[model samples]
Target: MTDLNSKPEIDAPEGPAPEGLEIVDIVVGDGAEATPGATVDVHYLGVAYDSGEEFDSSWGRGQSINFPLDRLIAGWQQGIPGMKVGGRRKLVVPPHLAYGPAGSGHQLSGQTLIFVIDLLGVS
Candidate 1:
């Protein structure tokens, strides 16, 4: 079951945001949402939100990964649970919540991106 609770960190109650991503309800849904520290497994595809250019994806690599909630980006930690088994979601992540100014293994910089994520299951 997917949980839907608005969080201050993800929702950024203090307006747009200073650093990190914010969730805007473009398509509000009836599904379970992720807790701040819940471990989950999923499939996802990321693209530049502004340019619509594809950057990364589990689909492109033909594989899915299961990692601790702490192992992923801060934005994903707050973004995954809205999707249930066989469900999908669009996560718009800002650089701060992602890899920040330093970026990560993906070389992502101050880029805002969108992810078309498919939640296969949670373990």
Candidate 2:
């Protein structure tokens, strides 16, 4: 199970946040690669980019979430595409591609967000 209170270990970006989305591999997997329009199952931890305060986790709930790659936020839609099943990646999402200026819920707003995601499978 995931440790809900644990902060994510985000590496310093090789350069500035890219113009679109940035994905860094934490664990390279040999499973099937994710592609646009594919349904994917994943466990993820979301946090603020500046503070690393965890805001959401699927593992904390003891379950993984499944969704179509094209239906998620622009940042996620862009970043998750090229990952492989069983792979772990860190996604640095700029506000423009995430929730944008409106943000989402109460935890994120206009701030860049970071997510550590584990791709479980693609169906």
For residues 62-88, write the lDDT of model 2, one tens digit per residue. Answer: 788999988888888888888998788
Instruction: Find the candidate with the highest lDDT and give its number.
Output: 2
Off by over 4 Å in 2: 1-19, 102-107
> Model 1, 18-108: lDDT tens per residue?
3445444434434455455666666676776556667777766777767777788878887765545555566788887787664455677
Model 2: worst 10 consecutive residues (lDDT sum): 1-10
Model 1, stretches more than 4 Å misplaced? Answer: 1-34, 102-106
TM-score of 1: 0.66
- For model 1, give the 10-residue run with minimal summed lDDT: 4-13
Compared with the true structure, model 2 gives a TM-score of 0.81
Local distance difference test, each candidate: 0.61, 0.78
Colliding residue pairs in candidate 1? 2-31, 2-32, 3-32, 3-33, 34-81
TM-scores for all candidates? 0.66, 0.81
Per-residue error for 92 in candidate 1, Å, reads 0.5
